[model samples]
Target: MCGGPSAVVQVVHVTSLRINNYGYLERMVPASPSTWMATFTRVVAQAAAGFRRSRRLFHPWGECFAGTITLLVPGTLGIREEYPCLVRLSKGLGFVGAVPDALGLAIRIERPQPWDVLMVSSAGTGVLGRLIITPSALWTRPCYSTLMPYQRADGELMWLHARALGGHTVSVRRNALTEAIKGAPLGFELLSGASNGAVHWVGELTLERTAEPGLSFDPGVNQVEYLRLYPGWLTAIRSSAYLGSRQSRGATLSD
Candidate 1:
């Protein structure tokens, strides 16, 4: 279950990395590369090649929309001001029948240096819930989490989440998401928290599919200095995978 933001706990600048009840940040020592890493790399490379040949590496066929994000209550990261953004919604694997497919919400904040926020559907908003990947058949049902923690300049880890609000509903099948959003606009209440503890209302995201555009979002590259991905090794692997996917497709880094 999700709770409101704490009033007493003073979450200052994200760079300061100080939360009232949260524990101190600890360094994650990297393990020596083993067969595990090699095998994973090989498999990912092969998969990226196949995806590149067919369509894309990650969310292959997605519907893009023009939207805006309003930061109502900037928390630790202190991301203030509203932003004009482009939002993309897609199913991870294109699972058929009753199988639940992981839903993705990719947002490109159109600032001088754009911020790409890629959120995946999560099991819940609690500690354990944020870690577990919860695939959903409905586009508006599940809560999308950043998955990997965003490290603060002061060494604190934070997370961003979005859950559909105001009863905007849609069942995601092969070709359903686009039509649903066309009839009724999709809206989500943005939430931020320490790791996955308790999330507070930070802002709102509203999306509309007026016109479509081909674009790619990279969380590793297009990042602001204030907010960075934590656990260097993990982000390194993610960046490699994204690179392979992009290269095989004969596509350069897109804004």
Candidate 2:
């Protein structure tokens, strides 16, 4: 139930807890060793206007879109395919306005081993706009950072990149970035390696919006075998952040 609206059937619910909607800060237990989780959860609760399992702290701004995507895995990793996908775009914060916030993208593929990708805005130039999150106009042409180190099959640590391929002519709107996506088809790619080295095209994704509710995306659970999480302090902190967010909202972490 956590990976997307379409993921509802696969949600593995654990024991639950009840929390006071307005007392998130007071009742939230530390999800990790870092003290940042407490402050982060408090800040997010304020932005979201309350504590509830229905929303996220960072990346709370959400819009559903659809497209076709291709996944180009390294031959050594043994994965490659093309599929129809659902995409969600949002600001990585609970701010209620068109103000600057980290932009995020989540793609969910409904295949045998449902794959999910979550990306955050990054700095660069192309048909894709700015990589940093600032109080500029929201455009579909933005590039998002995979924001984590990916472990290749050979145990190499790599980063990922995804740039939007549509909605360049649309204007920014207030309270919603949907205008950046309406009536426009969207697509993106996932690449590994670095410019200084042998870069590899690993995955491609296209997305569309629909009347049907999309599946909820939980990066903690929805993952592919080839694209593995990096091992390090940052990843640990990120896991803590997710745990902190879930605790504040009175939700269980997915298996």
Candidate 3:
């Protein structure tokens, strides 16, 4: 009886307004799990039909190449070792030939440690700018980023960056990126730091694309040594989306 009948009427009115607001939102954004799944299926079929539609929600290019990643400097746990790896180059969206789409590079390291690094092309540095830059700035010479932050040896937060060596361009197929990395060995370096901070080289990665296929790559599969995945809402959404995609593709997460 905080406010008696008058209070109850006010509460009812407030509830009605909230319900109406939700109804409006529902009309504006008809988002649902089933809707998302349907979209995924459609994209897959489109890509299969050679329509240039990407199966992945983001970074859908399916062409993967194998390589080796070597720690040039001591990384987390002071370990300097070489790990067999696979790198997948893709477009963020399922856009048709030569159309603008975010570019991506996903790396999976096996043996000695099993972890995945997903990088997206960006122009500016820092947390906010990283998300703002589109795929237009991507090429073989420019750097790609993981977007998520990692913890450094000294406990400082850092972002990961990868760049092609010898001034080579990692352009898209029909453009030049595919040809550039097709034959001869391509070299890349992994660096750590903030968008505007001092950059530190963590390792060197080489791609050959001649290795046989073995294991699948997923960032949510295993834990990386010192690299920390970004925390909170966005990370949670990303993890769920990744798991869903893997499951749909019949990929398993190892223990």
TM-score for all models, in order of appearance: 0.74, 0.65, 0.67
Model 2 lDDT tens row, 1-255: 566576435432211122345643243443435556544653565456545434565665466766777766467465777787777776565455555566677777766777667777766422222234433345455556665656767777666667655445432344244544455545566666542335556777665544233245656456678767776566556656665666555555221
lDDT of 3 by residue, 128-247 (tens): 655554665335644687777766556677777887888664546543554566757788888776746667778988887643332345564454666567663455556656655554
Error of 2 at 198 (Å): 5.6
How should the candidates be ordered by lDDT, best one leading? 1, 3, 2
Give the Cα error of residue 180 in candidate 2, in Å: 6.1
Q: Name the lDDT of candidate 2.
A: 0.57
1 or 2: which has the higher TM-score? 1
* lDDT (CA) per prediction: 0.72, 0.57, 0.61
Considering every candidate listed, which one attains the maximal lDDT?
1
Runs in model 3 with CA error above 4 Å? 1-54, 72-79, 124-129, 174-178, 210-216, 232-234, 253-255
Number of clashing pairs per prediction, in order: 0, 26, 4
TM-score of 1: 0.74
- Candidate 2, TM-score vs. the true structure? 0.65
